[model samples]
Target chain A: MSATEEQVDHIKQAVERWNAGPVAKLLAKFPEQRAKFVTASDRQVERLYAPEAATIDRYAEKLGLPGEYPFTRGVQPTMYRGRFWTMRQYAGFATAEESNQRYRYLLEQGTTGLSVAFDLPTQIGYDSDDPMAAGEVGKVGVAIDSLADMETLLDGIPLDRISTSMTINATAAVLLAMYIAVGEKQGVPPEKLNGTIQNDILKEYIARGTYRFPPGPSLRLISDIFAYCTEKVPNFNTISISGYHIREAGSTAAQEIGFTLADAICYVDTALQAGLKVDDFAPRLAFFFAAHSDLFEEAAKFRAARRLYARIMKERFGAVNPKSLMLRFHTQTGGVTLTAQQPDNNVVRVTIQALAAVLGGTQSLHTNSKDEAMALPTEESVTVALRTQQLIAYESGVTNTVDPLAGSFYVEKLTDDLEVEAEGIIKLIDARGGMVAAIEQGFVQKQIEESAYRYGQSIDNGERVIVGVNKFTGDEPPTINLFEVPESTTQRQLDKLRGVRASRDVARVEAALAAVKQAAVGSENLMPPILAAVRAYATVGEICSTLAGVFGEFSESTN
Target chain B: MNAAVKPRILIGKPGLDGHDRGAKYVAQILRDAGFEVIYTGIRRSPEQIVDTAVQEDVAAIGLSLLSGAHLALFTRVLELLHDRGADDIVVFGGGTIPPKDIPRLKEMGVAEVFTPGTPARQIVAAIDDCLLHHSVM
Candidate 1:
């Protein structure tokens, strides 16, 4: 046999000998040999990790980092050595003024950028005073009813100084407009304002349900933003095509990457079809992914995504710009991994996942709070989470080198394996017309559901052990200090909303809304008029309702 | 379906808490043990959830809340169901519920309060028991 064949033969012989010898001989040496093996019930079999067939070098050859094309070893030659990943934390709660304080706090604490979390009404396009906003105002995130809220949220924070990332997909254009209005008020030109908007709407239909318009109209709004952002905010990232929420909604690492990239592709194809050159906007396109407890898998996913995106941008789209070829991303550690049983364990999980993101070559990262499962993170808990990132960046020697696991046999092989698997999924999506069509057909959602089901089965069967959840039993579920939103914050927000409405000219708001409605129907970009409406103090709900009347709402397939 | 059969439970989130990890985990466990589950996505209004339960014709409705507005939100949902004459949907809850509030919640006609670390099997058995005692399936 050849050397490779000889190694395979040797492994087979060893497996056969182990199966037939030792314990077998010992069993034969005793009367209970057959009984010993038979007594072992089917229960243990369910917990075993044996695949139908074992590959050569489970961690070495196929999964190796550098050996793989589209290079998952660390997307670039110098990952952290050249520049540490951006520390972006999602922060926003209660009213605009309150959230602005938190935003400044996060920045003072060494956060590289800002990621805004809009409250329910704001996300669905409603003002705080709207009946729909009644019990929901500022419950989960900050309420931004008008440009006044946006101004307070961005108060004193220089738009040109620090990049801001907003997690608003449904009402992205309006929020983007508000962001621009803040930039204008600050005397900073739109081109100088840098940041990103989580404007990926397809994922909304598939995972997060904050969508307002039907798919076609949603695409039009998204494309409108894409066209406007490239021209107005040249440095700003238009859409953070996301798979992070998809994974948070119960998906595997592979599905997260596959589905997210599929969504990104959909956005790219849409923009390209909208008469924009691939190179013009592809460079500004960004991605957001979830970092789960799977260390190797998560790391492999980043590397795989980078490599896949590079090739797709170059070969598929025929993009010539080097920046367009690189898929810059922001990763948030999975909130689902945090267990309320022993919430402290979440610190360790976030730390590990954060390290994986850094090692995998993310452009930015967000480590979720340990107590997020229970409530909004307490200041103490948020500090601890922030410290987790600081410590990794400062103390961990892992950042000293570029692609620390670069030439490792196992990591390389795993990266390659992941790339191949993800590519296959992409091809499957391509055959079915792409992400938009695939999502409509329920392909992506079904895949995530299956993986989620399998994962749950494994956890229940003890194959996947969530510490303190399924394995270690805690006596008295330790008392966790949960953060409570102050009732006064709501009153303050409502007061502010009332004051802004009282001061702003209602006629101006009407004209702005009318202009927005006209732009929604025509080929004109919506951001400028939307900003005009925001400046006129039009409620977020009013602007969104206008678009809804034009675009319509989306009701998803239950299946 | 008779009370002897496994009581079908529809656990759901009735608002914009994109935190569905707990609900999804519970759904899988309930499904494996044989319970029909109807999951309403994030940002669902209280009325939508109640409408879904009545339409799906479920026996029990388990509202999961990680957002701290459980007291207000759940009460409104319950009140809506009562107003609509669908109060028969056995109401229960889970998710980040403080221990002190459990009794208050139970007093509000919530059949059970499942805190974190309560085993999946235990939840299944509890639902079964609650359905049998209440003579509703």
Candidate 2:
């Protein structure tokens, strides 16, 4: 509802009196930190927010009740009142067996879900023993070469009980197939398995650069997964259209939502063009985002994303299912914001980010370890990170009520402003023939590059303060012992790969790969053949290379 | 300050690590600092890095790795330079290298190793110092 002129005048008078009296007295004793207060995205924060500051014309239309159209408040009707946000800590490193131990440890520590982190070699579709995988066998995350590794990775973990999320792209199909096979081995049907794979490959081209194939083939593979999972694994999220990497690569909150939804638009359009019903597959679609340091802005970003996505699905695509309209998402704390100097300061930084995620209504969250800026976090550090979420869920009173910050004038204004700005960017992308074509023209990459460069310059010039990093100088050697993968890990992985190759049926492996190549050349879904190959114990490198021979590899045109 | 003889540097990312924000930022800052910079985009092998260094005839090589493969990748690039008779090129490394590994990286013929929180000016000054010392020798 619009404010009356008399009410506006009264608010103005009160603000003026407050500013002239107490504000002036305080300013005389101490000065403001900066002349202008801005958000992480450079949006100016007003001196005071009031009824006039809100941009909504009618509350019912824009800010409807929870679980209704344009779900701005939250997705679920009783968010956090029914249960707290899922505390899913992303942990994986070293061999599959070792990572499996970590997963069990987290589960025993009250982790609600499992999020797997694959090593670089596995992420880019290389086998552990490949020459390209040397010195990187298990450096960043767990190494999974075939069904044996996948089996070992999930040895004791109950597949039907625990929902797992794999942070894998480019090779998502292969890993998904391996996951399905492992479920079958555990006497669980594909329909009972539930999880999310970071199948958003366009972001890889724009932000992460872990892409293996060109855009055309990559989109085809994703389309195939959407079709396959719709029938085979109905409970699983087919694609987690991710903004986490984009934000980590240094995008503003609006850009994170803007580019992410743009990519989602491209995927939805691609699936629709492939003759799939929108309601059939869109229900399982989920999102992943980054929760940075800005409290209100981050919360507003999630709200804006939900509202914007609901409108897009309803108006743009004519999706009838209410499930298709709700923008469910998982959030991870921003790793780039952590500092190597004064590493303990990262604990405070992570607390702020995790709280932002929880307050923003994230469905699941992964809080980063404080020692991550130096290396892979140790077990002690990871446990502390997990306990940070525990403290918020059990101890903090923020989760007691739903949308606790709902009526704040500043948050509401920020939400409206960000929605409009992000819609403007999405319109520009739609004008250029959607995100894939835009990425092909290097437009998205250039935008992120400019943003990252500007942020770096801000730190370089002292315009932005990173606390202990650029200010509050300190001199202390790191006291925490980093978790280091033994150099023998590579040798051990190679030995296991050899053992698998010697034992697996050679004819079955060859036939499965041949089928994969043929499907790559044809219009058939590649998941079945890929699953067959994975079940036959063909290495990831073999299947990927076969398809690469048909679909070819991608090399980015230097910007 | 002559334009014709600006010290050329090759900024390359070795291995499958795709985090190129630091590499690209350093490239731009080096270019802004009046040096010719050529960037080999992500996922360049060690041979490709050294080959590009020789082919471009760059005065120095700036290698960035965030995948914990800095020791192996950096040493391979240095060994390749030595093998190809391009040992005069000043080599430096950056990106998430642990503090303890910095001394070992320096001992392996890397002119310097810049960790996180390093200013671009400090890196540019290090490159300048390396070129000055090389020219004097």
Score candidate 2 by lDDT.
Answer: 0.90
Off by over 4 Å in 2: A1-31, A53-57, B1-5
All candidates: TM-score: 0.89, 0.97
**lDDT measured at residue B63 in model 2 versus the true structure, 0 to 100:** 95
Model 2: per-residue Cα lDDT over B1-137, one tens digit each:
56567789999999999998889999999998899999999999999999989998999999998889888899999999999999999999899888888899999999988888888889888889999899899
Cα misplacement distance, residue A207 of candidate 2 (Å): 0.6
- Which residue pairs show collisions in model 2? none
Candidate 2 accuracy as TM-score = 0.97
Interface RMSD, prediction 2? 1.1
Q: Which DockQ values do the candidates obtain, in the order shown?
A: 0.43, 0.73
lDDT of 1 by residue, A86-168 (tens): 88889888888778889888888889889898887788777787766666678778998888888888999989899999999
